[model samples]
Target: MLNYLGLPIAASEHAGEIDHMISLVHWLMLLMFVGWGLFFIYVLFRFRKGANPRADYVGAKGKLSKGTEIAIVVAEVVLLVGYAIPAWARRVQQFPAESEATVVRVIAEQFAWNIHYPGADGRFGRTDINRVSSENPIGLDRTDPDAKDDLTTINQLTLPVDRPVLVHLSSKDVIHSFGLFEMRVKQDAVPGLDMPVWFIPNRIGDYEIACSQLCGLGHYRMRGFINVKSEADYRAFLAEEAKFLTQ
Candidate 1:
C-alpha cells in the first residue's frame, strides 16, 4: 500500500476521506490504462500479417460501434457525477459545531504566521493596518476600545484535544496557504477575504504547519508548530500566553 512518493500508507487523519478520494482517482486511471492496453493488444494480434494480412476496408465507414461508445460515455458519467461530485461537495460544507468549540485566528505575512486567541471575552480585538508596527504583530487598532483585551501569539498555535476548533485564516500581503499535512486540511489564505477551516484533534500530538503558496524569497521558511494537548495542558498554555500579552 505504499504511495508513489514511497511514503508508507496512511492510517490516521493523514489518510482521511481526502486520501480515499485520491486513491479512487488512481484506481480509475489504472482501469483506463488496462482497458486501452488490452484494446491495443487485441488489435495487434487480430490484424497481424499472419492472420488477416489486410486492413478492414469498412472499419471507418460509419460502422456504428454503438455498444463501445455507449459504455465509454456511461463510465465517464459514473466517475464524474457519481464519485467526484459528492466528494467535492462534502469537503466544501462547513464543519459541524459542538457545544465546546474553540476559535483561533491565523494571519499570514511574508515569512511568518501570527496566531491570535481571544481571551475569556471570546471577542477578537479590533485591528487597524494604520496602527501596524513591529511591536504589534496583529496591528491592533488603538482607537478601538475592543482591541485592548485581545491576546496575540506568534509562530506557534495550541489546541485542546477532542474540542471542535475553528480557524479563521487571512494573509496580510499576498496570497498564502494554511496547510496541516498530518491533519489533511489545507486552504488558501487570501488577502482580502477570510477563509475558515475547522477540525477536531482526536489525539494529543504536535503537527507541522506550512505555507503552501509562493509568497516571497523566504516562503520556504514560513513554518510553525501546532501542539494539541490535554484540557489541563491547553489551559496552562493559554495562561502563559496571556501573561506575555499583558506584559
Candidate 2:
C-alpha cells in the first residue's frame, strides 16, 4: 500500500470503509481470474484430440450463456448503485456538525501554492487581481475590514489531528492538482473557479504535498509539506502564524 503510486489509504479518515470496498472488489476480481483460468485449463486437458476426438459443440447457444450475461449485468448494476454511488456520495458529504472543522484556501500559481486562513473571524478577504503585487500575490482586498484580519501563509499548511478540514482550492494561472498522498486527498485546482475538498486527518505526522498537474517549467518544483500536529501544537502554530500575518 505504501509503495503504490496513488495516495495511501492507510491513514485516511474513511480508510476502513474505503479499504473494505477496495478489498472486496480486488478479491472478486481475483476469484474471477482464478476460476476462469482453471476452467480453461481443465477444458483444454479434458477435450484434447487423444481424449475426446469427437468434437461436441452441442448446446453452444443454450440459455446458459444468456443467464450468465444477465447475471453479469445484474452484478455490475448492484456494484455501481450499491458500492460506487454510495462511496462517492460519502466522499462529497460535508463535515458533520459535531466536528469543529477548519477551513483553508489554497491558491495555486505558476509553480507554487499560496495558502490562506480566515484568521479568527472565519471569513476570507475579497481578492482583486488589479492590486496584485509581489508581496500580495493573491491580491487580497485589504481595503475591506475582513481582509485586514485575514491571514495569508505561503508554502506551509498545518492541520489538527482528528479534526475535519475543508480546503477551498483555486488557481491563479494554469491548472494545478492539489494532492496530499498520505491523507489520500487529491483535487484539481483550476483558475476562474473554486473547488472545495474536505478531509479529516487521523494521523499526526508530516506529509508531502505536491502539484500532480503539469502546468509549466517550474512544475517539478511545486512541492510543500502538510504537518498534522496535535491539537496543542496546531493552536500554537496558528498563533504564531497570526502574529506573523498581523505584523
Candidate 3:
C-alpha cells in the first residue's frame, strides 16, 4: 500500500500503523472527491435555467445535503481524534527508557545535522555556545571527562537494527525538520526547545534523512544519511569512532 502511494518503505516498528492511517486518509479523500463530483453534476442538471426560470431564495435545505456535510465533518473528526491523537500520544508519552534505548543527540544547524553520541560513558558532556566553531560545531568541551569519549558526526546517523533509538533533537540556528521517510518519523528541531523523538528500526538498510522544512537558502541541499546495520557491525562502527576520537 505504501509503495503504491510512492511512499518510502516502512522500516520502523510503528511504520505499519502510520501507513495504515495514511491509507485510510487517502480512502476518505477519494470517497469525498467522488461524492462531491456526483453532487456537482446533480446540481447542474437539477437546477437548470430551462427547468426553473425562477430562483429559490432558500438554498440547499434538503436533509440529504445536510446529512452528507455532517458525515464528512464526522469522518475528519474521527481521523483526528481516534487515529492521529493516539499515535501522537504513544510516540510522546511512551518513550523507551534512556538506559535501554540507543540515546543520541541530533542538533540541526543552517544546513547540516550534527550527530552526537555519548560514547562508552553514556553521558553527554557540557556544551557552551561560546565554544562553538567551524571545527567543533556542537561546542563539546573536550576537557571535560564525559566529553573526552563523546563522538560527533556530520550528516551521518548509524544505528543497530531492532533497537529503540532515543534522539534529543535541537537546533542551533533556525527551525529545522528532522525527517526519516522510511521510519515514518518527522520532528521539528526548534532553536530553544529540546525535543525527544524515538523510533525502533526493524530493517537493516541505508536511508535518507531530509530536512522537510524550508529552513534557509541552502535548504535544498540540506540532507543526511541513515545507516542501519547489524548489532556486530554497529559495535564496530562505535569502536572505529572511539579510536578516531583518541587521535
Give the top-scoring candidate (lDDT). Answer: 3
Residues 201-231, candidate 3: write the lDDT tens digits.
9999999999999999999999999999999
Pairs that collide, model 1: none
Best by TM-score: 3
Question: What's the lDDT for residue 187 in model 2?
Answer: 89
Error of 3 at 199 (Å): 0.9
RMSD of each: 3.8, 3.5, 1.5
- Candidate 1 root-mean-square deviation in Å: 3.8
Q: How does each model score on lDDT?
A: 0.77, 0.81, 0.94
Candidate 2 Cα outliers beyond 4 Å, as residue runs: 1-9, 40-75, 95-99
What is the lDDT ranking, best to worst?
3, 2, 1
Q: Lowest-lDDT window of 10 residues in candidate 1? A: 6-15
Model 1 C-alpha lDDT per residue in residues 82-107, reported as the tens digit of each score = 86787566655856563467888999
Over 1-247, each residue of candidate 2 has an lDDT whose tens digit, in order, gives 4633242645558766666666667767787788679868987897899988788877447596677667767867877788878977876775444327888899999888898888778888898999888899899998888887787777788888998888889999999999887776788999999988888889888887899999999999999888889999998988887786656
| Model 3 misplaced stretches (Cα beyond 4 Å) | none
Error of 3 at 151 (Å): 0.7
The clash count of every prediction, one per candidate, is: 0, 0, 0
What TM-score number comes out for model 2? 0.81
TM-score of each model, paired residue for residue = 0.79, 0.81, 0.95
